[model samples]
Target: MATSWNGLSSVLPEESYMTLITALAFTVLWLLWSISSYFRCRNRLPLPPGNFGFPVIGQTVEHLLALRTADGIRQWMQKQVDKHGPVFRYRFVGYPMVMMSQPEGNKFIFQNEGLSNHIFWPSHISTMFGPHAVITQSGERHKLVRCHLNRFFDRAAMGRYIHGVNCNAIRHFTNHWQGKEQLVALDIINFFTGSCVCNLALSLEEGPLMYRILEETQTWIGGLYCLPINLPGFRYYKALKARGSIFKLLDGLMEQRRQMIAEDHVPEALQNDILNSLLTVPDEEGNLRQDSFIKDNLLILLFGGYDTSSVTLAMTIFYIAKNPHVYEQILQEQKLIVDGKCSSGENENALTMEDISAMKYTWGAIQETLRLHPVLTGSYRKTVTDLEYEGYHIPKGWLLNWNSQHSHYNPKYFKDPFKFDPSRWEKRPPPFTYLPFGGGVHLCLGYEFARMEMLIFIHHLVRNFSWSLVDPSYDGPIIRDPLPRTKDRVLINVKRVIAS
Candidate 1:
């Protein structure tokens, strides 16, 4: 074989070698042409400045590490913003994203509904809320859903639920924390807000059903920012399973509501809660909302109401606990309201819409907490048409994100942005500068409801109990994924406030 190969090599002419070289040159030229053509086609429209990071995974690992830290997602985003202006592009979990932290960018993305109408959610979030969720909808469907849901958060609705919200707050504090030496603020507030939402939305009582739903909802939300792998043990898989169980429970509840309506167990006037309203209310054509629609909106209500409200309440408590002067001011404001009620021969414990309105200082503290630790760090939107901003071209179909933390922390918007100052809110910041509940048409529909809940909770909380941080030396940053949560769950010590 060796001798045969040597003979063949010797017999191969110099012309044959020349032919091989020519073929190799042609192949190289073809490869170069293809590469240039691919780039030219893809770059017909210039993209925002960003690093694609590594292939496939992109910058997902960097993002995950940032989330594990105290500052969480905000720190990672700030670094990117510092390096690459307000509008910079990045890839995360295989999706191309353009993040905007400037007020102009936020206003452009939020107010220009015609150009940016799509809301993007992680698969786990979309699956958990289903297809008909108000947050997931856009255009006419979104407007329709928002109109229906708006009734539940209006002034009239807030007035009707004031008593229920007050009762839930008082009961949770008195029953759960009267004598406890230590309390996990997150756990307690979750139950408080969960119960409040259940009572207000479904007219449901506190029990295993509500508890199960809360548990499953948390499981699902916990995986919203997780990797999108779907294996059995993965977070996203577990979340999907949890979502299925939740939907099953919701289905049964919807069936019961239907049966009650059919049997006339619930009167027309009594059909005021969100579930009943969704089930019984009809469009101009008199067609009832589909059960899936009802269920998805219900899930949205739960998602919007429960975690954000609870985390806000918890942070409020932590801030009050940390700032003695602020706590005292809040206590004084709440005491004045209570004293006024007592002097007028009204029940001091009952919170009316009027009383909640009078809680100006307490509301300020809550707003400050929201500014420092927004429950939703940012929201995602997809461009519907190509847009240009600041000499950068944003092609259609690109993802856009406006971060609350960026606006909240920007010195241009708020002086001493990191300091906790409730008084700063006494004078309103510029439009789009304070976006804890978001801005523009797509602003959070439940903003009023959340504010009312927090205020009512604060009213009862300050009047009944005083709290202090469990570990004064422990200073950890907040975790923003799955909503803004304290690193230590805001552990605190509580004691009843003795009336003089």
Candidate 2:
């Protein structure tokens, strides 16, 4: 085959041409060596059954490709599961790794965080979230950060958080949604989640700075889930640029927060936010948490709330339309909440913690959405020491991941697994079999926060308007803007409802 560089070689000086050829040769040789190393240790241990495909890239291309199709990851994983059972080995991005799809594997990874396994994040996640984030930390540091952050994130803080969330949802809908007859749901939902996280986590109101952060956040998310290749024209490069800008904005805010705490002049608006509390709140040792630690956790909340909430809620839009039964039931549930206010002569329509708590069927649909359309495919852990399970040997330092495909979609754990059945949530699935928010100490800190954000927005949505898909015939994979969304914009028509 003729090289694309055929004409370039003729124009180049002879010595330069030879040097270029040498460089190309060296690149090929290095890749060959790197790929060989992944196979060398395989013969030494009973590493689970799998193959290392291609050189350097390994199975990464396949993984990326599967992401483009609906139910692709689970489908791809199922093929390997059929051939290799619950435990299997595969290579991605030059790393030899193992993936498990059984509840046993999920339980083991969660329950043994510091012993058999330790937290590990892939390149894209760690880079985007930063090094000091608790999710990226392991051992004592992880516990330390978790303990400090828990004071603000635990159930006790819910009262302080919900009021702002409630206020924001009402304001957001009034300003952004009420007047529009048709709009892109992805853009609308992303804006709502991003703004809420920033306000609750950083005490920003609707303004230029908050909107700027939200804009950059949009850029950062584009690369969050893609392969971590950093070259130009790649999504990860643009994401890094976005992170730089967002951190600069956050750093300026943090300094102001630090000064406010020092002066002992906390504004009522800022008092409830996690930023104000983190800057002044003492830890178990009576020491204020470090700046980097606070910033990292805040970044985590931003990513966690925006990514997962947007995905689950977007899927909720899809599923509600696809399954009309769910929509009717959810609307029925929401209308009753509206009626409760009228009966009590409450003189207000804002959703409260009590109102959200009453959304049993709606929460069920949310759970069902999370199960079928998780923002993340799974979690990754690194072996702390050489380990053996199911009579297979795993040398220390091998990358391992636990995916929920087998457990979440298996007929044993969920009847007619592919079908969207919110009623199935009435009785919880077996332990460790359903973990959309994960579990153990490593569970997402924003779990409750995300839940509340979703409930409040959904409550407003179903109660205030009736919606229909602008393009009902379309069905395709949810594109990843660092999380699941429709490939084509999911536009919906809404006509505001007057209360009965």
Candidate 3:
């Protein structure tokens, strides 16, 4: 009997084996069901024509990781537009990104539907920027902050800042370049612009604190754009820590500001500045919220305001040096305005709105600089609901990559896009074509301030120094880690122009 039972058992499959097989089959079925569900649910959206890409880790590999250079993102995006039509899907890491390149798509996102307000920043982004930062806000609340801040953008307010702006520019230039050769000119300019924004936005008394916060904020910003992996001692982890330090510092500043406001040390008139404005203003619900919002948001403004203007100024300086023809043209335009030849009757005594408006070419140069090297490679938005486009589906929770740089650099959209011709902007491009300040309701609150600061600083800078690059071949590869920094700090030699 025992021998018979043993032989039967040996021949029969073990219970454990059967159980293992069953689990495997179930897992396989579940995977298939999940994939099928994704496809079924995804195709329901009215999305533009595109690929779904791979499961989980999408086109993030190339968009963020593979392409670290300024032009790399544009090159990759152009290829995608060519292959997948104006609108297509790319996966970054596991995130599915719907890329839109067509004018109609751009219109839908930026101008018409008001999709530019969507803050598709990553989870790690809020961790650093805090929930109060402007990038984290949307809809009506964003409008509230923007409305209060608009007073700062007024031409009258800009006028008040001009004296301080010019003073800093002149002081920094004269102090830094006592005996410096022309080769070191660009670095001096960079330092001066950084200081200029710091002084104009936050009073000079808060300079060190603002600079530290700006540095920390930029590090966190770069890290937030990185892969979400939280391995020990990684760049992302360091960024997370830096973000904590930043918020802690901001919280302390907020408390200090609130105390000052409570004591009536801060006047109502000064409330128009970034700090006081947010403090005095209430949310839509009429609740007195925490001060974290003001400090963090102001911190964001400082970074955005300073970093972008500096980059543009640097590029403009480069163009002025490399292409002296453009420099002479800009100089002549300035001369016309100064010599009372322009429509704006104002002169060097006071820079009226009319006077600033007359320097059209100066403004054009700034636009062209941005066209060539945009601060942000692309704009990202995540779906809050299922949306359909052209017989396809974009499921809720997928990311949308508005590849603005691709459109900016495309030869089809821009004639000889790679060439740095400010004249291209002399005749304005389409509405959404030039979005350096971004668009929609979430358009940069500091846009006006930034433009004014750049215009004023550049006007003063170019008038004083004639600059040239130490090494003309220094334009090698730019690391797009924190707002398109070159591999080397661009060194320019500067000397007072001694006209022959």
Candidate 4:
């Protein structure tokens, strides 16, 4: 039976009918107001011009596809530059963003970070890390957490873990690489780094729990690229589940660490790991950090150690294998360090803070690798205020993206951009021009730790082995594991060389 509007109204009470009409009228009025406000803004302040192409799924597929190769993102973003100039608008997975690719813009973003703009992580990531996690915080809360985190990367803290990194490399090569001739380099690197994080950071020995944490991390990481939909059969859903499982598992370990602290029985070797230190020591104010802070950041430390170190370390190996001249220089550099230790009768193969510092060329090579093949090309920030940038109205709530490729590949900053010259790093590039580890306050807290870890890995790799790329001519088609990586397995033929 088709009911008229009057008939429907009659079926309900008069008061109820009036309430429904009022709700509909309010919704329609609100929509009208919103649409009028949008157009008003459009008339008054123009958005930077560029085609985002379709809503909700705008430009994401194309963006992801472009990032699947080495130099692909640079080229893709360049096309946008060629057409729309450096500062322009685009939609990434429905997020409307303006790409700021100048040193001045980079400076503006970082300088005004807590004032005009702030760190912008999606709700899914914030949800996964918990609301209190460092990645999600800003202003004073972020400062408090960051101050607590400083203890983990101090010189003394790094000194404590130097030998462990060396030990992990030796064990990895012995257990996994000794017999293998041809293998995927990244896979080997990932496992080695995973063990380093587990053993050195989490205080987990080579056991079932260690493997379980690493496995769960993989699932958790997969969710970074997923939409934040909490439904059955979604990657984000699986990622959330994985995050819960990891947190639950970490809860038990945190308890163990607490018990160890209470008993005052932490071994000297175990003292270096961040968790033990975080659990036992008071912060600058002499208060122990929150349990949830320790717990969530354990997730940060473990994953940060792997994702940052593994790819760049692998790329260092990749570039070294592909470029013989570069490899020769690195080999010569590492040889001298080893020779000095042997001459002095120090533990001949032992790596120390001094040894890591002396690795200038090798470190330069890692830096060059980072510049050419950044794990993340850029990061997202949010505007806290409406502002003018490069003559564009970047309204608040829109994302602001600053890409490194702008400076890394810009000839104005680099003499011969796109060339893999480690010597360029001998002198630091101008401010905001080279941001492999990013720059300013948010400049990767893991920077020094990553540097030390990579230097040690290279020292062992160069001194103990020689390798060749499976595809010598392949530059790359960098794939994204939520970060840029070699699309090819980065297959290589590696062989053991002279022991120290």
Candidate 5:
């Protein structure tokens, strides 16, 4: 039908023009392919299946944003798991990532001695936290730092510091509540937890500068959890600056501690806080690590320990206040302790390790809060070598993630997964079923310390006052990220509960 030259050109294009265009396109594609192929070949481990996006960025941004919510990304992952079984590959950013989700898979990945232990935090994060931070260190160095750090967090260590802890708690509350007409107990709770952790880390009391730094730093880290990018003027950038300023402030504190330790001017009882623990712990070679190592590691503990615990306690308070029955039950339990009729029957207010253990309902409430709103939605890892689990190949050089909420909410794992029922944890859900503090070798170092801190604050607050939502409009589920406060910042009307 197109025998004419014009018709021929319109239908197929001129041969000369088509040939030239095809050659140019082919050459451009070849160059792009070669570059991508080189990177792919260089990083030749069978990565866990993931969404591979545009080559350079891979799936970083997409992965970060998807995981920003509690269960949104996890629900998606569950759908994939349901379709692909326990192990599968999915497109992330633009890269293929293989993931293993079965409990056995988790065990396998966690137990393997040879699996590379590098972290997968963004460049900006690593830069701000410092390269040698124990969280990122690998091999023998990580082991040494972790071993020494564990000493400070163990029961023996914390037990010795109880007086110090009580002092910090009292000071934090008294200072916040002393002269305010309408005190925001939530923020006060936050500051209290922050001060508790600060005392643990640097043995320094929270003051005006420390509070401001804490506030600014919380904004910064909270911003990074959502906006994982570092474009200029971005929320993450501002947060990064805040983080740097906070680090500088911490540096000053660390220097002061070191000087005090050097001069033997520090209190004997409080001298062995995290910073001192690192400074005093000697390696097999009998050599002390430099001040840089001590400072970075202390920052790691301060950041990880305080931030997660404060958010958790805040959320628990939100739940307890909303469900007055739960609050009353906890108070009754506390009273039983006071009346020496605790379950196993212990004195009230003065919780022994046994009493804290017996407070199953309280612990369950914390678990439920964590399950519904994990302080961290996920954790990231980078493979050091090719690995395989649950029939899926995980290649080295790819970033992998453990999506916490999806695991926590999986109906197969927990009954009525979304509801805030603390009873589930009373029975103690299966291992890794509710990982608020993460799992495996990287399980949070400050877990026990956080628990003690939470229990102490909750015990005191529950005893002192009764509170409820102050504003009617503040009624709803808590909002997440960019600061995980209640929708209206958990504005609660407070009244001092008289002791009978």
Candidate 6:
């Protein structure tokens, strides 16, 4: 009986024992694979020094949170720069990135167009702008589109558009805020820019359709930096819907233009605006651009035109209002132009291209605003081949970012960098150090257009109104989604400057 019991105890189930051994073997194999993979990727060449915090997610949450406000972003970058020198490596939004804040780094990245291209935006941003848009295009296709668009923003073209820009500014002020006690500067400036761009780009009059377009564009802009999950309640999902709506609206508009052109309702020379130009411009094969290309490019222009220019205009107002001395100097500069017009028997309100050009001091003030509150914090480029910089090896297929704000606020580049001093611009900072409009082949094509719009608006604004911030204590925590904007939306008290 004892021998039989011992035999039973020794006969453990084969299936259970086999399962336990299999699990142990798999775990050991996984550990070995992970260890080898880690060792293989360890950089042989020294990378720009910085921490890649946490795995997978890797500094992305902190990076996005810092971008919620301008001060947060500045402080965050400053801290990293202090620790890691001007060039550093970090992981953010699923990319291994090297941030270059030094002027030499900026020059190398900007000048090496063949090695780097503007294809570094996340999935959500690329979807919003469309693959056909100029922002996403590279090489010969990019040059072709740029060449076509350049004709509309040249010196002669800007001279023609000045009247339209002036009219929009005057109408916005008069129709909306001439008698108002207080208004949100962001809202009004957005309206002003939307009106101006609509008229210039598509010849769309201020009406129900224009308002609809603006509404949809704002919704689309709100989603540019979203998480890109396509769930029902997600910001990116809503943005995708908004983009579809905009495409439909723009398609209808373009179709109408085509029909009008076919029936001879609109003449070729008379249709001199951007939409007309795009519709008529021929490709290398001498074929007219497709309607889809026209619509996509038009959307890019409209969003680009209104979003950046408006933010800069609003910040300029806030800065000027906060600093009495700055305001006084700007007022004096604008007044000189007004007075000169009055003396020359020119229309006091009508701003000509020559008149816009002569406002050098006014331009300085706008440039200063751009430097401090840059519309784009930074831009991204992707490496086509492995590159070396500052004794660091940046692998091919990695992303490189040149931070305009970091450079702008670097004490090494700008003395007393925090102070709002327009005078700094009178003597330009070193190249690539002050790239408010960006640099290289991908430099903003609408830069001149943006400058003219701001100048024209400032000319009208200072000449006619005296304003102050409603909340004097509100230093901006600028929220940058589609672009940088005030957290408070920039409320201000306004009174027309009655001519004595």
Which 10 residues in a row give candidate 5 its minimum summed lDDT?
341-350
Candidate no. 6 TM-score: 0.89
Model 4 C-alpha RMSD to native:
6.8
Please, what are the lDDT tens digits per residue for candidate 3 over residues 1-500? 35665566677689965776699999999999999989976755455655656677656665675457777777777777778777787666567777776555656665533352266677666666668777777667667766666777667787777666656655766677646775443345556656655554444333577667667755666675777767877778878877777768767766776888889886543544556556666767887656677666666766676666777777677766667777877877766666673345544634555667887898888888788777765566666776666556777777766556866877877999877787776787876777777766666666766777677666665666576777776665766665665555567777775321
Model 5 agreement with the true structure over 278-342: per-residue lDDT tens digits: 67667668998776777667667767766777778777877887688899888876666556644
Q: lDDT (0-100) at residue 34 of candidate 3?
A: 99
**Candidate numbers sorted by TM-score from highest down:** 6, 1, 2, 4, 3, 5
Model 6: per-residue Cα lDDT over 413-460, one tens digit each: 899988888887778788889888778887888988998998988877
RMSD of each: 7.6, 11.6, 7.3, 6.8, 9.3, 7.6
Off-target runs (Cα >4 Å) in candidate 4 are 1-46, 229-233, 262-268, 281-291
Error of model 2, residue 380, in angstroms: 0.7
- Residue-level lDDT tens digits of model 1 in 1-500: 35664566578897986687799999999999999999976876566888879886788778767766437667777888889877899887677788888888778878886445477775656776689988888888788889888988888888878777877777887788888878999998888889988877787767999999999989888777777778999888888888888889989888888899999898553488888888888954689988788877888788888988998888888888878999899889988988998999998888888887888889999999888887766778888887777777877777788777788888888999878888887888888777888766778898878888889888777777888998876656777665776778899988887752
Residue 363 alpha-carbon offset, candidate 3, angstroms: 1.3
What's the TM-score of every candidate structure?
0.88, 0.87, 0.82, 0.85, 0.81, 0.89
- Residue-level lDDT of model 4, residues 382-500, one tens digit each, is 88788887777888888888888878888898888777788887898899888877765677777777888888778777777889988888875666666656667578988889865
- Judged by whole-model lDDT over C-alpha atoms, candidate 2 comes out at 0.81
Candidate 3 ranges beyond 4 A from true positions: 1-54, 111-117, 154-156, 182-190, 229-232, 267-272, 341-349, 498-500
Which pairs clash in model 4?
A: 69-477, 69-478, 70-478
lDDT of 2 by residue, 224-275 (tens): 6677888988889988988888888989998887788778887877887788
